[model samples]
Target: MPPALTSGWSRVLQGERVLGEADSILKFVPYSDCKQGCSGMLYVTNFKLAFLTADRSSYDNTGKRNRSKILGDDDIPLTNIDSIYTVSLSGKRKKMTVDSKMPTTETLEVHCKDMRIVKYGFKFAPKDQNKKFVNTLIHHAFAKKDTLLFAYEYGRSNELKDRELICDCPMFDTIIDWEDELQRCKANKTWRVADVNMSFDMSQSLPRYFVVPTALMNNDIQKAASHFSDRRIPIWCYTHINGNSLLRMSAQDSDTDQPREVSRMLDAVKVASNQRNKPKIVKVEEKCPSCQEVQESFVKLRKICMSDTMQEFSNQDAVWNTSLENTRWLLLVSRCLAACNEVAEEVTGGKRTVVIQERTGWDLSCLVSSVSQVLLDPHYRTLAGFQGLVQKEWVRMGHPFQRYLSLVTVSEADTEQVPIFLLFLDCIWQLLIQYPAAFEFTETYLTTIWDSAYIGLFDTFLFNNDHQRYHFSRNEGKNIKQFKLPSVWKWDFQLGSEDFSFFKNPLYLITHDEELVSSLNELQVLSIQGMFCRSSRNNSFTTSLEQNRNHSQDARPERIDPLKKDLLVPNCSSLSIRLWTQCYLRWQSPAQILSGGTPTQYLQQCVMVEEIAQLHHKLKTLQLRESLFVEFRSKNDLIVSHQPNKSKISELLNSTALSSSFPFSPGPALKEKQFSFTPICSYIRNSSLDYDKYVDDDWTGTL
Candidate 1:
């Protein structure tokens, strides 16, 4: 027989001593060399996967000149491997490859994310052995739980490496009842867990979607499903009050709405297999116009688009008009959306966890699931919180950001980009008009998200989604910092007064004395879920910019609070003016600069534009406040209900230091919850008076 899998070792491979992989096998695969020129054998012990060359300096163990292997000077650890697969003649390649290859010989390609895919020609002599080598390598490659596990699972595996998970690992207590596909993340010694105070025994269930109180209870079940032998996974759950939360997923059209479970197992499996892309993280649509414009976003905001009164209007003779069919269809959509909203409200407000799945579990599913969080959580009402929500729910969760916006082109066909996120913004716009103070960010912020989203200015919004982007990052050997990714909002903005607003959403604004959230406008509900394109003639709502201009005289400095002097905001619409002025400020003669623009000019323009934006936000904020507290003084409700945003205003331009300690609390809605700030500390563990006395090298204090 060939050399044993663990043969040719200088010393006995004791795996358990390595990193708690005590029971794991010590696998040895001997090959001529890897494409990275790792000549010798691959020794996969518990601690790491190392490539060791045949040692020439052999130590004679039994007083015999027996050649034995010792540690090579240049061994490479394969601990951070992203993917390893056998390259069969698989019909050439998916993309063009510059290098030539023989159709017969098998090449074992190991794609380490940080670097390129290293190709190793298998010289195992036996084809079966080579195949087993590739298989065995992949088996241990994925079933790992080291610090790199999260990065590997999320960042790598893009090559579709097969992993038939063997249920050898012990399950977490929270997931005993969940499907096997819903595996919990492997614990890493360095990473921290949710605070003990924030975690609680979440045993309750409800019809509405709720955040899972326990960790390991929530997962990107659909995404994780693709990695397992069984392609079934539980729904993505999140932390919520009453142990309930809502999820939005796409579904089939009304024609084929229900499933024929009455069919045989094979038939059902086939049907289910076809719907694998469901629980879609982003809105993906096919077909469209050549050019898209910002003006196209107004259609979803119509009053009738969200209400259920379309059925009553369709009774008229005008209903037969084909042009009216679009309206009718939109109305029907609104009705369905309303029903879903009602159900969600019941569930979110009640104690039920709701899972809204459409034909594919994207589109509508994303809309409702995300919007539900905005409705239920007050933290989401703030600018920092809103950014956090999108990061967590859309970007981090995987919403196909790359597919929607073409990275290469500035613009594309209307149909090429999905306006799911746009629809969400428009819905927020309606909320802003209704609850002027509910969201910290204004219409300006929403408009900025749309404008910069396609430009790829920030890495946070650059990727298609969390998994696809990070997956590629791992392939390129990027630093996979746990619980952190590139973000668009700066520390100054997040901690500043510019992003703070004390106004509540309309439902909450009017009834602060009662329940947290009572109701929402049906029209706003429908606006949150569709590609609404309304005729310009029917667009009725006047933009806040225009409204502010008509009443500019009323907003004069003399008539307003002198406190507004501290506010540095300008009108949101005046950004173009600022841009022009800024560009002119750096206009060195055309002869001094090349015919093309200079980097200095571009950089200067960016800075000026940012300054204008900050000023505009302040202006709009102050304007809105004036309209409510001063200009609209006759409106008793507006004046009487102003919430003093004492905290938001205090640090408009201040840095939040990590060393500062405070008794942090998670707002009213999340009364029992605790916040996580890695660089910052909310409370000190040690309460003794001498705790602060030790200020030496061995302080041993964590912030």
Candidate 2:
């Protein structure tokens, strides 16, 4: 095979290997290593990724190169790529780091792993072409990933190239099913939106088809914009008689200044809006572009006006500086979740769909939308809907579980893995613990999902995109139809809810007859526990919902004194509680060998508030020293003086107000659950039990 036929501007592919007709290979780039002087044509087919080696003396029928040739050995297996990212080729800083005489090249890093890591680096022509390549690579990788997942689940070994893909359709008919359900339920409304309850939000950032609130059609709205044509990505909407919302997932904005794209989003959101007018972009911040001179001036002036964290870079403090930059993404996700909860509350779906950007609308977008739905929509909590929710959101919406599977065992690299799915499940577990009976599945169900997220149990949850997943699952593979893959919920039918009582979350949310607004304050973020679980005061085997609810509703305050449960109960492995933390966590975290000689140790140490208080008291007795003097300012003179008061000082020193300033306080820790007092909120202050009816109350601030 001459390289010229496989590559160059005029290079063409017959694509005989790809089953049926191949989707057009839309883009191509010439990849060359400046140092090695090796060249190749980087092209992506519908089913596979192949790069043909090109001879530098490359002239094709198009007369582009001097002499172009293809090397068949250069093709890369797209399935092996674990993660891919690009390097910046712009900026004076970036330019200075490389040779000026070198070709404009983009560093493409592909991390391939099976039993070990095999990294592939491709230096493609043109600076900053890395962005386009990264997307193409990921999207293609996802397509291959879906094929592999479907094949694996169908008991097809890695070698089964002969099996045919059957479905060639979408996953679990969330959209199609909902459309029929909606139309049958309501004759008046025209639900042309398809699946709003589940779809991929087709913003630039969210290019993949995944579970979204509903899929939105960008092409329908704008025939003028070139990019917006025939683009029907998921932006599904689920409407209720009382209210409606458009929970959307989108790719990040491609054209930052594109008004037509923004207008499309606003229009789609406006469909679910309760407002009389359309919502406008609320510019949160503004920046002024600086010239080279201004940029240099700012750099020189940096010392005079800079954040407290800013300091001169030095090898001695390099360790500290590196961690600060690494922590930015984690902090950003936390802040975004907090802000999204607030947005969930103020959604004016009656007039406008509250559009909270789901961490730029992809992985975390699926999580944010699903969690928000569970809170707002009661349907998600149901048995059937919860299964649909996972199928639509986590499965259809792309959560790269394959990339995360490596996390089960410890690897040196943890940077590429995000706990989006884990965190989402944690949030749901909290709901399950709070409202157990409200869900059809038991604790076992949650744990099973968590485990599967780490293990490749079901293919539905593994694929990277929706469209290819649809094709792969149905039409791509050649297989016998009699051995059909079983439904994921087969375990539910096998074992009734009775046996999985140990998996139950203590809390239960009973559905209300009338739609009720769940509070934003209740959406609290929780931590990941893999190997161990924190001690819970309630230890009775899954009791009846009535019994649990009665205890949950009781107003009795917990005592600071240590409870018997802490001293009597032993620490248990988190395998029973949190699956990801216990087993999957083994790689990143090693199980410490305990002194007791048992091979297995408890997941976490059972630390209770009472035990903590006792330890604190013991430590305080040992560490607290008599302060010879205390500092105070004279009331009239703004001067501090050191004076010692013995008897009264000792009492004041022991008081919580004073002890609170100490680095460690061990006394019985106060918790929100332990507080029986009704909060003195704004409403309480202005109630019918007026201040005038009682004694003149002490006020902190003057009116």
Which segments of candidate 2 are over 4 A away from where they belong? Answer: 1-150, 153-176, 180-190, 195-234, 237-244, 249-265, 271-274, 279-336, 348-351, 358-360, 403-416, 430-444, 474-484, 492-703
- For 1-703, candidate 2 gives per-residue lDDT tens digits of 3344344332232221322111111122212122222345455433234443454423333211111111122333344344544434551112211112333324444433221111233433433543344455555454323334323434332222222322322244444654553553241243353332123343222223222222245344333223332232325434333344445534334554545655565565554434455642211111111122222332322222211111322321356434433433223333333433443444422344454343233455566566656654556775556766676666654555554443222233422344456556655654554444445444445655554443233455444555444444554645534223323444332232222222322233221211110220121113243111122332322232233332232213364122211111111122222222222211110111112111011100111211222233334444433544322221110001011222222222232111111101111213223322221122122333222212112211222
Give the number of the best model, judged by lDDT.
Answer: 2
Candidate 1 global CA lDDT score: 0.32
Tell me the tens digit of each residue's lDDT in model 1 across 13-70. Answer: 2221122111111222212133223334444433234433344322222211111121
Query: Model 2's lDDT to the true fold?
Result: 0.35
Q: Give the C-alpha miss distance for residue 613 in model 1, angstroms.
A: 25
Q: What shift in Å separates residue 595 of candidate 2 from its native position after superposition?
A: 18
TM agreement with the true structure for every prediction: 0.32, 0.40
C-alpha RMSD (angstroms) for model 2: 24.7
Question: How accurate locally, in lDDT, is each candidate?
Answer: 0.32, 0.35
Best by TM-score: 2
> Model 2, 81: alpha-carbon shift in Å?
15
